[model samples]
Target: MGKTVLVTGGNAGIGYFAAEQLAAAGATVVLGSRSDAKAAAALTSIRSRVPGARLSHVRLDLADLASLKTSVDALGVDSLDAVLCNAGVLVDGPERALTPDGHELMFATNHLGHFVLVCLLLPLLDASPAGRVVTTGSFVARSVKLDPADPQSANDYQSKRAYARSKLAQMLFGFELDRRLRAAGSTTISVVNHPGGALDSLTPSRPPVHVRGAGQRLRGLPAGLLLHGKDSGARPAVRAVLDPAVTGGQLIGPRVFGLRGKPRVEPVRGGAADPDLAAEIWAASVELTGMEPV
Candidate 1:
């Protein structure tokens, strides 16, 4: 039987490309999206790219913590080889938004929701021979520090800073999960990866899902040397989940100055490897989400 992988936000951008590559690799790719129309569109697009691709979809709204259990049950699989925690919300507006769960929008969707979802799926993940949880972090995470005390960003809520801090929290969670899994001697592993610099202008067209215009292609040419399309950006996460050589607790990203190139194993930077901070963040997550993965 082929491996089964669930990719959150697989309907578009980096997650979409990752799903396509995995499907082409013969895995059953389950695209997690909140919208039925978008999921159907993505399924068609992927099938167009890779004929006879095995695909499915589950209604997943990461920001709505109340609905995560229903979403997991909707996966309709007993075992999952991997869960790509790739769905995220980037709130760039000046006004800080909150999820239905009352947590910061970005933090809830990007970090806490994934955290709870993984916790609920632990049993299914453990059933696989080598189950893996791949967290999709960001390049911006490399510079920000997550304040465990203010994880929701209630005290200081700059849109950009809040977004960066949420990604940082996710990276910390990934590393800390690896540590916990190792301590428990589980076969499952956790890995963190970041897409260096992915832009729509640089991305190739995937009709019905994504279509880059001629003007966009021309505008993206100059940055091509240093920036890449979302397709290239999807590589590190795909490598982390599918590559046998990738072990737990490792950070992976682009090879060239962490900007744009082939995916490679990179050092964990920006306090992502700090165990104390990770533990603190882990505690905060548990408190905020009422879920724990161990």
Candidate 2:
């Protein structure tokens, strides 16, 4: 039997491709998404690509904390071999939208929601011999200046900054999680990976959203000369979950300038390695989520 795995935002983009890779390698994937229709469509898409793929969908809304609990409860699995915290928000509608739980939308969806989910699912992860959690991050995280004073980014409210802060939170949390797991003598590894500038514009996904391939390729050539499509970007996260060599807390990204290349161990930057900041972020997440993971 294949290992049981779960992936957030598995309905599209890198998450969708990562699910395909995992399912193709023999695993039962419990996909989580906000939309049932999208999840269903994604399942069909995956099945078309990988025949006999074991897949299921769970309705999850990061904006709604109650829904998150209910969604996990719906899954009766006692243990999960791996979980990819792949769901996130980038080009959201509102400039500074807040979740139903009163937290910043991007911060909640990209970081806090995944944080709570991982903590809640620790038992299931512990049940596996070598459980893993891989959180999706981005090169944008390198520029974030996450301030505890403005955790919500309500005052500044720059869309790109908000998104960057959220991504940085995911990276910090991933490292912090591994630290805590080690401190507690657990084997479950928590790692983070970036899709290497995996722009939707360059990828040809079904139902095609944002067809800016030629333009993005031309425009991004200076910064991301070889920017990856989504499938290529998903490779690093998949490796983080499946690779035995990937130790806990290690950062991973595309080798070629983090735009388009093979997955490789990369250095953490932009104050992301500060232990004090990680603890602060953890405390903030726990307070925001209203619960600490066991």
Candidate 3:
């Protein structure tokens, strides 16, 4: 119970599984969710699986700036070994929804909220011995182009395109974080992971019609036979946070299609390899979230 770890959106899906695995490994797992009931449910589920699991629940809503700060306040301020930014949402409707802070929903929840949380906790993290931050990205990062001038996709918002763009931001943040922290003489590791395509049905939103297309149908075999399990998808994330072999800027995931095979440290996409774009995204994120780098 000494090494502290927090997982945003850890109440369900891949986040829940990651928390469970980390708990089983004897780390204090704090499940962050907007719903207290769901957070309790997640804690109970983890205990049912691992009787000795050290777990707790805290409120965290990525869509609301005040909620983010409130959740950060509720968390016990202590040196954290790692913070897994796994909370994300895929808003697939035609209408563009703005967050409480008046930012795009997908971008705010998937990227900015975690960005704020990481920055707020960076002081505690930097004070720890070998603290780390791990962010969950997606294979969709390959499909989008990051235009700094139009970071929010305000002019054109295609549902799937918006989702892809958010993922790209996630990857960009990971790379830029590593570069900046190293330059600042902080050893905090910033690593990224993608689940490829896993069968995670915990999200409350529906996928856009086009997103539920032929690929999903062809791969509609069996959850076990086709898509990777949440545990399998979370392997790279687990390694990134826990394994000493893992390093900053390393991308981890399965080797096979949709990354369903064994997990390993991998390289991110080339388009997401722009240092300049990453820096711009970092600055934008700080401004958007009102979070200062610690």
Candidate 4:
């Protein structure tokens, strides 16, 4: 039997391309989307490209804590070989927004939601021979530091800062999970990857899911030299989940200056490698989400 992988936000953007690539590699890709219509469209798009791709969907709204358990039960799988925590929210508004759980929108969706989902799925992941959790972080995370005391950004809130910090929190959780799993002597491993400088204008058209106009292609030509399309961006995460050589706690991303190139194992630096901060963030996550992996 082929390996089964769950990819959150697999309905669009980098997540869509990642799911397609995994399907092409013969893994059973389960797409976690908030909408059934979008999930169906994504499934169709992948099937159109990869004939005989085994695909399914589970309704997942990461911001809504109440729905996570339902989403896990909906997976209907005996074991999950890997989980790609790829979904995230980038709040564009100047004002802060909150999820139904009363946590900041970006932090809840990008970090806390995946944190809880991973906790719920630990059993299934453990059932696999070599279970993997691939956390999708961001280049923006490098410049920001997370305040565990103010994880929701209540005291200080800015759109870009919150988004970056949330990603930083997710990366912190990934590394910490690796350490905990090692201490427990479990077969599961956690890896983190960032899609360096992915732009929609540079991305290829996927028809009904996403279509780039002629002008977009012409306009994005210059960026192609420095940056890359989302298809290329999805590679690092894909490699993290599939590559046997990738060990726990390793950071993966583009090879050239951390921006644009083929996926390669990158060094963990800055706040991402700080064990003290990771532990604090893990505690904050448990406090905020009321969930933790066994």
Candidate 3 worst ten-residue window by lDDT: 202-211
How would you encode candidate 2's per-residue C-alpha lDDT over 75-120 as one tens digit per residue? 8898899999999887555567877678888888888889888877
Return whichever of 2 and 3 wins on TM-score.
2
Say which prediction, candidate 1 or candidate 2, comes out ahead on TM-score: 1
Residue 53, model 1: lDDT of 97
Please write out the lDDT profile of model 1 over residues 149-261, one tens digit for every residue: 89878988899999999999999999999999999999999999999999999999999899999998999999998999999999999999899999999999999989889
The lDDT for every candidate, in the order shown, is: 0.92, 0.84, 0.80, 0.94
Superposed model 4: Cα runs more than 4 Å off:
none
What is the C-alpha lDDT profile of model 3 across 1-294, one tens digit per residue? 356788988887778878878998889988889998888877877887888888988888887766666787788766889999999998878999898678999998898888888888888789788999999999888978978777889999887898888988988898889888998999798999887677643212122201234555445555556566566677777777888888898888887764587778776666678888888888888777777564
Q: After superposing candidate 1 on the true structure, give the runs of residues whose Cα lies further than 4 Å from its correct spot.
A: none
lDDT of 4: 0.94
Q: What is the Å distance of residue 122 in model 1 from its true position?
A: 0.9
Prediction RMSDs, each to the true structure: 0.9, 2.4, 4.8, 0.8
**lDDT for 18 (candidate 3):** 83
- Off-target runs (Cα >4 Å) in candidate 2 are 91-94, 207-224
Clashes of each: 0, 0, 0, 0
Q: By the lDDT metric, which is better: model 2 or model 3?
A: 2
